[model samples]
Target chain A: MIPLIQAAIVAVFLGTWQMLSPALGLQFFFATPLAVFQSLWALMKSGLLFYHAGITSLEAVAGFLLGGTLGMGIGILLGRHQLLAKVLAPFLTAIYSLPKAALAPLFILWFGIGIDMKIFLAGSIVFFLVFLNTFHGVREVSHEQIAILRLMKANERHLLTKVIIPSAIVWVFAGLRLSVPYALIGAILGEIIAANRGLGFLISSAAGRFDTAGTFAALIAIMFLALVLNRAITFAEGRLMPWRAAEEGREVPI
Target chain B: MPGPTAPPSRKSSEALPLIEFRNVGKTFARGALEAVRDVNLSVAPGEFLTLVGPSGCGKSTLLNMTAGLFLPTTGEVRYAGAVVADINVRVGYMTQVDHLLPWRTLAGNIAVPLEIAGRPKREIAAEVERLMTLVGLTGFGASYPSQLSGGMRKRAALARLFAYDPETLLMDEPFAALDAQMRLVLQVELKRLCRLLGKTVLFVTHDVDEAVALGDRCIVFTSRPGRVRQAITVDLPGDRDLRVLRYDPAYLAQCGALWRLLTPPVEPAVAPQGRRE
Candidate 1:
């Protein structure tokens, strides 16, 4: 029943947009749903959609993994080491607050408008989100839990793996979930600035030609990609922390 | 009717003191708050000693010092004839909160200590099962801490504490968070386990009845800047059921005595009528 309502909502929205396009002179700017579908069909047949979408997906995933790993590592390190964290805190905050789009052109200059540039831009954006969450997560772990493990003769490795990492996992996942869209945005922004391929290039190249339908097709593809990635993350979190799911399950019935 | 008191164990008194506090005092926040002061006490091996005091009177501080979580501000805490300067891994500490890893199942949480010791898979599994049964959590081994009741979680913590088989247990009101009926049940279970394992326990509580019911010797502390007011030997038989023991005349007398010891002295200026509010 919920799925039916959701599907009906989408149908009605598209139907209204398609019907009102000609009356409102929106066809040239927003494009009709039929026109956008036609544009998508054309791109699919020519395999341009797959080629560009593949490049964009690769950039986003690569950026997300590299950035997420580095963020988690640095966050854990800084969280554990007070002196190092204190010294580097100001610089990290400054970098974190900077508009990521402003860094795209600079990244392009550094990495020469290649896949490296897009990856670096997306990765840098992802790094801070994951890093901030993971750092706080590590810091916020119950000191009582740490003490318990210590008294149980837990060495540093055991504490990290068993207590610290597990305790901070929820925050890490929060960061990961939050950064997925930002990762795509960073990749697309880099491609818009200087790339010859990727979904961002498709959108920019279409807009340059005033092809509203083509631009909309690329955007719809990007939205779908974001949805898939977010779903994948949610799945991984559930797999990794089954106990957390059980906890929530216990709460709902009451 | 038996006498109100007998005597503390001669066996424990004869044994070498496993934990000793020499002129121990602790002040936190750069001497802004004094938690305990000029405390000198010792726990003999295999003795179940309870520290009874008002809240913020530094009962927990004494246990923390024994665990080597922090050092005393003025003096020292010694365990097994050596000054404890680091985390003492030989003692198991349980506080009011269970502190179970939320992501781990009961079996997994209980297996923590054994895992830390690098026990093999089969052994850890066997030990975890034994502990689960010991704590009456037999079939609930697969359950997470969040799935359990307050009493059940406490049992899981008790199982986890016993998994490593530490020689001494430092419990800071471990069952204080439970309901009255559950608290009594756990108290009996804890006493039984402590006796069965021959563990030397330093249990802290504000409950006068609890202090009298559990300990071989109960040490009463004055309210804040907690100093030992008296150390009373409970002298009760170890095997008595806690429910029956609660109504025993001797037990009631001990509890009454501990209550009086814990009551703060009235100030001269404060009117007696004003104290009611």
Candidate 2:
């Protein structure tokens, strides 16, 4: 009930601002909040909201999977082979240093104004983040534990499956949390640059036609999408790492 | 009788020590320092040896050589009269660090070796349950290491080693993190388990009481660039429990002497000539 009242207050304040915008001559640029909500309601009624949202969500999910898998694989590999990681460290850093947005034009040249461009762009951004995190996670695994396993005559496969991967998964989940928003941003940026569909395209096209309310509506939809994706990943992380929550109070005596 | 006992061994006490360190010298920091030097030692199969020392005395380094985790810089460590070259498979080890994989359930961590050894799924499950029960973790099979007490995690570590049932055990300060009562409980369990299994053990600790309570013989060590100071036989009665031996006059006397051996000698206070009465 408190939350609902707080929200109501925010809504009323915004509504008053919207009412005063025309009188204050701020309606042209400010995009009255009521107008934005009404436009969003219209898009929902017409089913256009889900259409653009579906396209953007699909692209983001595809990119996330592509980048996350490849990142994890190479991350674990590079993490396992320190020499290889050292050799490639500078080159990887140079590439990662450039803003992922700078790759937009190049991605467009290769994949054209389709989902492919956005997917690749998103995948690349997500990949580097996950890779770096997984690498650090693998390296941070206790050398003592590895020594203990070795004394048991544990082979490399045993070490990898039993210890290394499980430890690294914690970082992978962290990467997932950080990468989800970036994943959406990547997908939307590609659409904004050239795509015919997606929330980004909807917002760009609306802005071009001076429909500021429509632009606000699309932005709000994108925010909702990012929130949902982030929530899903958070759920997965909790399920995958049940031990972590228990660790803080780990030593309760019997 | 309530705990898992050691399997019967036909080898007699007169048989050669299963593990021997001959003139073993281990140098660390690129040979800047010798952690241990000319350490000559042997443990007959099924004999329990406790090594006690102050910090930085290389007691753990000595145990590591026997486990083949560290190769002696100057001399070789032998197992059953043969020099161990690589990580030795014949020994089960528990170190001071937390080794229980947090991701695995208690049962899963305990069954790691069996899985590595290619044991079948059904048998692995059964064996894990058995080991858990042996370590008094009967209902904790599904719990992760993070959910357990410090002592409980030690039990899980102990169970993991026992699952492999190696001929020898090398433990380095395994219960050093626990409170006094917990340490005693775990130490008693280790003693009971070692005696019943007839497993040869090279255990390392700084606590003299623990060394006396669990060891057949306690080896005292000197400070850095360590070497054996002296070896003291515990002489606690056979067929006895650690709790009983902990308070026994014989045990306390041995612990006292070993503590003296471990501590640096105190220099006599000198009186100033000007202040002489």
Candidate 3:
């Protein structure tokens, strides 16, 4: 029911946009939604859209995996050892809060205008989000729980894998959910700065040529991919944490 | 003619007290105030002992010292007559909160201590199954802590505690968060389990009735800067059911006595000073 209403609103927006484009005496730079769809169809026929999407998807996935894993590892370590957390916390927070996009020029200069630069940029953005969330998750574990485990004669390894890791899993997933969009954004921004391939490059090239329909086509493709990725994350979350879903439903009217 | 009552047996050599704290004193330097003063207590093997006191009485501080979670300021806490140098693995401490890991299922939570101890996979599986059954959580092994009710979570915590079979169990108001009926049922189950396992148990609670219902000996402590006020040994037959014991005259008397000891003395308020109009 909600989806139907949302679709109707989107259709109304597109209908109004198509109606106004011709009436306003807009230049060729402003394309109607039908023209954008036609451009998308042309790209699909040529298979260039698929090729560029594949590159962007690869960059996003690689960055997400690398960043999420490294973030979780360091976060858990910092969370467990107070001395380590205190020593590194300031530096980490400083790096995390810095405008990462401002460093795109530096990354491009270092890694060249290849997929590597895009991957690096995206990974950095995703990493900080995952790291902070994972660290907080580990810290949130109850002292009582640790005390109980200690009394059971559990060794250090046992404490980490069982208590620490399991406790932080939810937080890690939360970070992942928040960072998924960031992953796409980072990849696109990096590609926009300097790239020969990817949806970002397609949009940039199209805009430079004054092909408004082609630019809109690239954006539609990016939006579709983002939606797919978001749905995948939601599905994974539901499978991994049925209990959390049930608990949330009970607590809130929604 | 009536049958004679059985003679009390001497403390078995093998069943000697496992954990004992002699003149143990803990003082937290809260800027200036002393938190706990001199205290002494013993936990006999196979006996259920409860420390009952009002809030801020340092009852939890005392338990923490015994669990080796915190060190004493002046005196020593000994496990099996040896000074505790580090966190004692021979004791299991369950805090007032259930503390079940939200991410793990019932079996996963129960298997935590075993997992930490590096037990073999088969052994961990067996132990998890055994504990689930022991805690009456047979069908709910895959259920997460969030899916459990308050009483069930506490039971899961107990199963986690029992996973390693610690000789001495230190519980700090484990059921204090539960509803009255749930608390009563769990208390009864805990007493029965302690007797069966022959574990030395030191349970801390603020409830007088709970102390009398569960403990073989109840140790009463004073308010802040807590000190041992009295130790009362319950004279009821060991195997008697808690439900039935509530109706017994002797049990009522013991409960009444412990309740009186717990209630603070009344003091008259001083009259306010008046100023001239």
Q: List DockQ for all candidates.
A: 0.75, 0.52, 0.50
- Quantify all predictions' global Cα lDDT against the true fold: 0.88, 0.84, 0.81
* Residue-level lDDT tens digits of model 3 in B1-277: 1322322212323354566667777766652655567787766667778888767878888778888887888788888888886788788888777878777778888887787777999999998998788667789998877777777888888888878777778898887767776667777777766777666788898777788888878888766667777788877776768877778899899999887666543123321123111
Q: CA shift at B173, candidate 1, in angstroms?
A: 2.3
Best by DockQ: 1
Q: Where does the lowest 10-residue lDDT sum fall in candidate 1 chain A?
A: A245-254
Candidate number with the higher TM-score (2 or 3)? 2
| lDDT string, candidate 2, A1-254, tens digits | 99999999998998888888888998777789988999999999999999999999999999999999999899999999999999999999999999999999998899988899999999999999899889988998887788788767789998998889889999988887889999998999999999889999999999999998899999999999999999899788779777776776566555
Candidates ranked by lDDT, best first?
1, 2, 3
Model 3 interface RMSD over true interface Cα atoms: 2.0
The residue pairs found clashing in candidate 2 are B6-B196, B6-B197
Write down the TM-score for model 3.
0.86
lDDT of residue A177 for candidate 3:
92
Q: TM-score: which candidate is best?
A: 1
CA error at residue A87 for candidate 3, angstroms: 3.9
